[model samples]
Target: MSEPHPASVPLLEVAGLRVSAGSRMLVKDFALTLARGERVGLIGESGSGKSVTAAALTGLLPEELQICGTVRLDGVHYNLVGASDRQMSRIRGQRTGMVFQEPLSALNPLMRVGRQVAEALTQHGTLSGHAAAARSVELLASVQLPDPAEAARAYPHQLSGGQRQRVMLAMALANDPDLLICDEPTTALDVSVQHQMLQLISDGVARRGSGLLFITHDLAVAASICDRILVMRDGVLVEQGATADVFTRPQHDYTRGLLAASDLDATDSSGRLFTVSSAAGYVPAAARKRVPAAEPAVPDVPNSTVSESARPDDGAHSDIRDAEPLIRVSGLNRTYRRGRSSLFRAPSEVHALRDVSFEVAAGQRFGIVGESGSGKSTLLRILAGLDQPTSGSVQVAGNEVAGSRENELLELRRQLQIVFQDPMGSLNPRMRVRDLIAEPLLLPGEPVAARHHAGRVAEMLNAVGLPPDAAERFPHQFSGGQRQRIAIARALICEPRILVADEPVSALDVSVRAQVLNLLADLVDKYRLTLVFVSHDLGVVKHLCDTVAVMHQGRIVESGPTGQVYAAPEHEYTQRLVASSLSLQPGSSLPT
Candidate 1:
């Protein structure tokens, strides 16, 4: 038999692929070709068929949907429009491996991490149990998971988000398949971890000489790693070309809009602002430049910004005298104890936070900006009363948190609420929308009848841009964006004075993210609530926040108004962060 014609035949070929759900066509006439060892990226906003195309490629589409297309891999033709389940299963893991967006759910909770990987390897006939176990360790090491031997014994919940993602990567690479598909693998990760994950994928594909299909909505991320990019909009393939050409000269208006709305800096133009404590020998130049300068004064902006008389003079600081602070923390610290190897050895302590102090005034949208492992979440948890600080005090609505008795603490908790990053995990699967929204009101010492609460829930649903009947659906019945609206309604049910949103919309689609953000801004204004917004995305923070606080290694290095900090950063770390934010300015690549 003739050797497989590598040049004449594509590794994976998708032509005129189309999919629809009921009356709506989610993916329309999508086409692409990938040669062996080539990496291609697919980018689009929510409901643009990016994920649908990915699902079709791996034969994971739901039975309710209709598909029509030609999909071939390694010169073997397969009609995905009506392919059998057995045929698809034979091709899925053996020939094409996929790493899903959520690693936590993708990996089995009951199985050990190592066994999960080994199972894939053994099922593919790549190795026996013993050999596969050893290969699993190697795979884990290849992804740079620390102590692969020990981590193999750990479960999915035991590892951090980044680590679990690495385990997912290991499973995808276990069989050494010719094609690897990664769907927004870094969406939940921090910037540093995201960079590392991309680098790992790039290196692994090169070594195995495999074709890669990367799906994401983040333009900067796709631009950084992909050789070619395909832009999709509303179920249609708008454009496809080299990454540089597509980014430099986008042909479609939707493509241009996506690039513009991404808010990621194309280059590292600004100087460093604050030192990153986790990174060695990383001193920010901006910190050195402020040697002789005096401390700057805060700017004055009215609480409402509605009344001309209430507005301050040009140089006056913003006022919070009459209004109570929504969230307050003084000298807060959190320490985690690492287990000791021997009985005689004392457990090692990890200082997640140290001397963190700040206040978010009522109706003030405050920001906590930081890199990974900088204790941003730790501080948010303390303020939300999810976790107690190792030292220092927390006050919410003038009620002392640390010193309060159990009864008093419960009341204080009612006045404060948090919206976490992962909407899917945050919501309960068994509960319907109405019960989830009414949960906060059902807390101790609250007055909310089923009849009266149903109306309030519906009102909250509408406020978050959801339909009134959305209250009747279950959590999984809605899309990611709609589910987030349910989460928001749950947070607002108690009419809390303070809202701690920890990376709330970061996982959302760009278009959906904007809607959620606008809703948050409006809600904050109408309720006169204090907002502690924690996010790694600097662009979002700049738009949503009135005041900003930069955190590094559990400490606040800089704090001031958003405009002042963005325009002229005082700390080196802050400068780096601002610069790292992707920009669409002419003649610029991704910021270093």
Candidate 2:
């Protein structure tokens, strides 16, 4: 028979791919065909087997995982099922490159990032030693990393999230593989950095005529990069078609739900957000009923715990601008010593916050928006009394936070609580959800009776839209969204007047993110709590916050009503941020 036509041979092909962990199947009947220079996206929520499918394709799955599949890469055998380590290793970098979701976890903390890139090149003898080292710097530079030479010498922990991700990209592209697999590589990135990353990935693949397998939970991101899109749900492909076709004319209910969730502008008349569920389908707001909160065990903060009727939209607080400020920061400055660069040099100081000042009125929904390294976290720490400012005034509910001693913070602790970004990291894995939610009540100088713990935990679980049985389960037993609910329940257990959420929904899938955002909105309204929400997502901040403060380079660059600021951002940085944000609305496109 004559040799197959060059155009007919696909760059990557998969048939009947399935992944199982014991009796449970993680991925089912996955199939794909990608031609050279083509881009395809696998879109799904968490636990939907997007990553599992990727792992199976890359031969990176654990040995314990049962995979029955065929993955064919160009120049490779027709069937790569059960490929051995030696066989897989030969093509891992030279033929296929995989960029993982979390670069921090994927990268070696002890190794310098540049050295890691060099190692990728040194493997398979493409380049070694000095040549590889120089090529590594070139790769880093190609990814548009600022000061690539300096970045090369730094460890993964030393770099920002965006920088670390760029480093991962540098490594993934070091060998110009025939196929590139990026697994939610931009999930944790800020919109601006995420835009750059997507462009870089596109450019990299375009330059080498490489086929791309991009996996993500974000429809906007998938739209920005992929030519074709495959919607995965519950370990199976529900729909597959051209990117525009699938997005605009979704045939499956799950696909429609994903689209509905992605359209952040869409909301019910009551301003309730929408979320998708495998069980209940998708609609206005979460399906679960809001559970009433238990009465405060201690003297609650004045005007802190308002009834549902007192919600801001109900016209109960029309004069919110004239209300007494719940939080005030004036001339805030936080500096940390970096020790001496060299023994004889004067000590270096990193200015984490510079003259940062803002006020949150009682029951006000305040937002702080900034990219990484913009001092948002530093400001949050000072507000929470976790760190002292070098020079500033931080008053929460008329109590001093900056420079306050631990013993002097009991009242403040009861008045304010924080919900961190990564619930898994913030929560104790070994503790039952009951204990975790009730732990706040056991704070120093404030103790609730053991008899009340069960009642309170159950109430909190219901308040956060979780099942009552969730209180007895461990954090590991819950999904990412569920774990975040647990974190939120724990933060609200003490009925704190102020809730400071730091990037709480940044890591969630679109559907889950909508659920969390809506929950936070409803909780803030119901409890009349002062919310200081920090996020890099401009769209989210605009949707949820009344007032927003734009931060950049350790200072508050702009502060005004969210609508005004978003409509016409004055600061250049703020303008860039607004332009860089991705939207799934009609006519939305990736920023140039």
Candidate 3:
């Protein structure tokens, strides 16, 4: 079926948009037209030029890139092909507002959240300071931030990921822009929060009658909220049509490839590990038909003999009652106290986690999925021994976390490690790769010398797909993917039995994400380690975890085997999560 064409004049238009970094073309012949009050979604994988095109529209391309295109905002025609910084700045934040992927970095840390939103309003027009602040609070309230007045006084660090995004939205809408461009705004948010954020943007845009250009790598997200869709590849528009029609019947080969790649098929139940092949080119139908019919089709599992033999050790610990959990939490709770006010004023308490309980078995891969502000990270922090639960029991390797002495906690720390999502921020700029990997080995009782440490570092580096010589390089010298590998190496240096990875692959590119996930899977089997994998990506969780736990409002709403939970999600939130994941193939539902 043909898609409905825009009835009104386009608020933003681009023609023959081309961009290059050095000699390599990043975007080519990209074109899109967004009508006033319309919502258009751009979908693709990482490095597909979705972000580049969004940046170009606002003249926010990096200095190194050379662009050539005709960009029209409303009736104003400007050649974005080679526009100057000054020319671009005049249009940015005035006629258009941008919501970035990472709101923490996008917002100013030093300024009050309300003030930041007000600044956007005050900069573009004649609003006074008090009026701007009042409008900013109203904007915050519109995005559904609790206690909007008090929230306005908070800084970016004081807010949760969802709250930070809300603040970003408030700031972006402060001036009532003609066009709002959101670049992966919900990428970092959990499933339910992601839904709410998308809905919020759609609602606000409709209310203001402003045009929207939503850029995301997630197809399902686009499907849920977009009016029209544009599929981009290598900076070119591969397909453009109504959201339903394009996803249902993608015409372009590139678009079809993207759809196929996003499939979440389970690994074959016949005890085989499946390796992902990312070679350039498409799989022929004849070759696919030649495969044995008896072989089970599991989507993300690596096909390798080694993986086949490495079945989970469920039988070794058959007596579930007798088996000890690698990590256990009972009645765990966490609370944060707001700063003091006047003498008579009581400090406000934020209950981040309220009596959460769960157990992780040895050699088992467990998942914790939740929305923003659900205390998922808080629970993880307590599990990693980075933070103490307010009032409850946490037992790690058979030691009571609350009753353990400082030395006992330190000993427990060696058996537990965490890998955060932002690898670049976690790594030290001054430290060499060798030291970064070896730092965990320097515990008081360990006897390895510096020379032996270097050897161990080399081994670990190679295990995670880094060169042996990577040990000598600095953190800044590596790409985002490589730095994450270093972080993994550092976490595993002490051979911790329990590895807590908090959204480890959320920030990486799609191709790199697959590589890291595979590396982690191998390490988990080789070390017989228990993994606590926390993430918002259902596809990754399904591929790696044996068990899944869904968290909502700081409580575990659903817990079961990965297959069971995904196949029959009892909770509405879980169902939504499974639904929110983008499928490469059109009209393909999750296993349920």
Rank list by TM-score: 2, 3, 1
Q: Which lDDT tens digits does candidate 1 get at residues 448-513?
A: 665568888988988888888888889999988788878988999888888889998888876566
Error in Å for residue 569 of model 1? 7.2
Model 2 C-alpha RMSD to native? 7.9
Cα lDDT tens digits, model 2, 330-368, are 999999998788988999989999988888898888889
> Could you give me the TM-score of model 3 versus the true structure?
0.77
Each prediction's TM-score versus the true structure: 0.73, 0.89, 0.77
For residues 466-488, could you state the per-residue lDDT of candidate 3 as single tens digits? 99989888999988889999999
Query: Among these predicted structures, which one has the highest lDDT?
Result: 2
Count the clashes in each prediction: 21, 0, 14
Residue 26, candidate 1: alpha-carbon lDDT: 93
RMSD of every prediction: 9.3, 7.9, 6.1
